[model samples]
Target: MKPVSLYNDIASTSYPGRGIVIGKSADGSKAVIAYFIMGRSENSRNRVFAETEDGIKTQAFDPSKLVDPSLIIYSPVRVLGNKTIVTNGDQTDTVYDLMNEGQTFEQSLTTREFEPDGPNYTPRISGIVECENGNMNYAMSILKSADGNPDCCERYTFTYDKPINGLGRFIHTYMSDGNPLPSFEGEPTLVEIGNDDIDTFAEKIWNSLNEDNKVSLFVRYIDIASNKAESRIINKNK
Candidate 1:
């Protein structure tokens, strides 16, 4: 059996609103992006990812108490295939639509609002495809939260060769949005197990996480030459 390693397992609960994990999948052909918008409020508790003509759309499943949701959970672009984009709140479809119409990356994000979690602006994480050749690049920004009333924000980007065999720099900031920016500092961890070991590893990781915090876990592999990729998302609550 091929030896597998731990990549990153960044766990965060800072936003009373949502949690997003974006990175490269093991075997590294496709990008891995998981978003879980959670809250005690009824609107926040509902899920919001749906397929759209251009790409994907997010709408309050309940649509009752959700306020200004358009700016809160939208992604202005989507990078799929060789490019894929995922955001927790909105703008997801907008991004997809623009990209489908041939808009440039930055062009797609031009009108979207910063994240709502500020000091980090609602935190937005993205996994951008670097080339038609299938390489991965990523970026995320957080605007200041309401507590700061404004005047605080943070932006970070990690774009490089894919590292599926080991760990890379994992963000460490907490849900509090404070400095000393928290991170999973140990050598990066990789999660590339053999097909045979996936079940066991999945069980271990799934059983170990808290019920509410446990979101979806996806793994993918690709043959660079063929440009074909295989992937899946393990939604524990499903």
Candidate 2:
């Protein structure tokens, strides 16, 4: 395999849209997971991340300013036992519900597709980090339109059974900023997870995102041996 370029700094790109990063921490003692959202429109920008009973949810920063909640508002993270589920859209509930009924991640996503926002048809990106028997593994998926054709939906899932220490993979909703935004292609990009401190790591990522476009960010570190978790959240609006 060709050496995957390490995305050490996320600010290098102007807009990565929604993104997820999963990997093991530098000390190799915990599994690190991060999810962030960015937007270009007023409706998309008027949002914040709020902690929920099991995970985190996106809420309107100013309810009166929320134009459409159809696609912008939803739970982004949920914890079901040792599985921590995260996604860019409502599929977070789908994966949670299906898993409760004894279904695999891939099986749950089979029923969903890309977003309906064309000409962008924004891809739905999802991820789950499974900590079992003191070992950590993760899976990432992207559902997008086939060749920009709304009629056909394309789905791809990548599983990482042996997460490398200090390394992570990043997948985002858009390849970059554009008129009719392009969907992220190929496998998730490899990234470096430098700090063992969740707060430091989360701040670094938040600082790296494009200031004007970044909306909210969430990061969690789960101790593999004890299954204990620590998390940090940052909302640009707040």
Model 2, global lDDT = 0.90
TM-score of 1: 0.56
TM-score to true structure, per model: 0.56, 0.96
- Mind giving the per-residue lDDT tens digits that candidate 2 earns over 1-238? 3324334447767888999988898778899989999989999999999999878999999999999999999999999999999999999999999999999999999999999998999999999999988789999999999968999999999999978778889899888788799899999988777655888788778888898999999998999989898888899897
lDDT string for model 1 (71-118, tens) is: 544542344556656554455665567877898545565555445443
- lDDT scores for all predictions? 0.42, 0.90
lDDT of 1 at 179: 46
Question: How many clashes in each candidate?
Answer: 45, 0
lDDT at 119 for candidate 2? 97
Return the top candidate by lDDT. 2
